[model samples]
Target: MPPRPPQKPNRRMRGFEPASGLLRDRIRTVGEARGFAVSRLLTHWAEVVGEDLAARTRPVKVGYGKGGFGATLTLLTMGASAPMVQMELPKIREKVNACYGYNAISKVLITQTAPMGFAEGQAGFGPAPKAPPKQTDPAIRQRAEETAQVVQDGGLRAALELLAQNVLSRSANRAVTKKG
Candidate 1:
């Protein structure tokens, strides 16, 4: 065998780390099984299509034509919103294709149903409500504030305090969860 050239010192054998590697990979696999090859289309629906459109429609599945040549995306929407969604099909198709980083979706199909048809649409015809921030333990917040107090820059101190609070809050949550 020929001798190999020197490799980069920063390189490691382990694979690149994703934000939530294990759970994300598992979710992607499950999504693909349901014909959602681009899992981001499911997870980040609101970001891909603007919040307004996303609130009225949800991607149901990605069905490919015979021989897997053309892909059609199906969306679920309330009956009253069907006409609006129909009018926006082109825009939806464009946005969804953008999410795939290619012209992957050839057609967009809208399925209209009652407010709670097939037990779907229970999430309602509106943008998901923003989750309120989790409250940090008083003790944790106080400690973090004290630790960051010595920092000179106001912004840096605030950032450090928030980071410390998050770390402490997560550890505390984990401890409580484990005990329960």
Candidate 2:
């Protein structure tokens, strides 16, 4: 046989795989078999259930009968909120089914747990405290007020001065924080 030229790698084949894309097939296989659209349900839990309910509960899994389709959704909730969630089962089921575009869920089973519910992996942390509003230099504030005095509207003049003051103050705080 004659020698052949070296073939270049296909550029189309080279691409980044998203973290989620790698697990998608596995999630679909396990989730669908159990009658749960796990990825969709988890991603849109807040939309499927109201914000209030979603905050208090987490979807655990779905169990289907031998016939299939009409599966029971298992939800994990804090003991205190379980009763409230129990009352809203019908509403939750309807919303979930709507997301699935069919009557995919027939029942919602509430499982109560300790106030600290199931941990997906790492422990959850509370939101950080907001930084306090920065204080502007008196000279800068005076200059901003004097410059904004050109605007005839009282509200506009005050707003302009305040905006300038805020921008300067925030920049000053950023510089100080970066130094420290």
- Highest TM-score among the candidates is held by which one? 1
Error of 1 at 2 (Å): 39
Off by over 4 Å in 2: 1-17, 116-180
Clashes of 1: 0
lDDT of 2 at 52: 78
List of clashing residue pairs for candidate 2? none
Worst 10 residues of 2 by lDDT: 119-128
lDDT per residue (tens digit) for residues 67-170 in model 1:
78679999988888899889999999999988988888999998887666676335366544899988777999999999999999999999999999998888
Error of 1 at 54 (Å): 0.7
- lDDT, candidates in the order shown: 0.86, 0.79
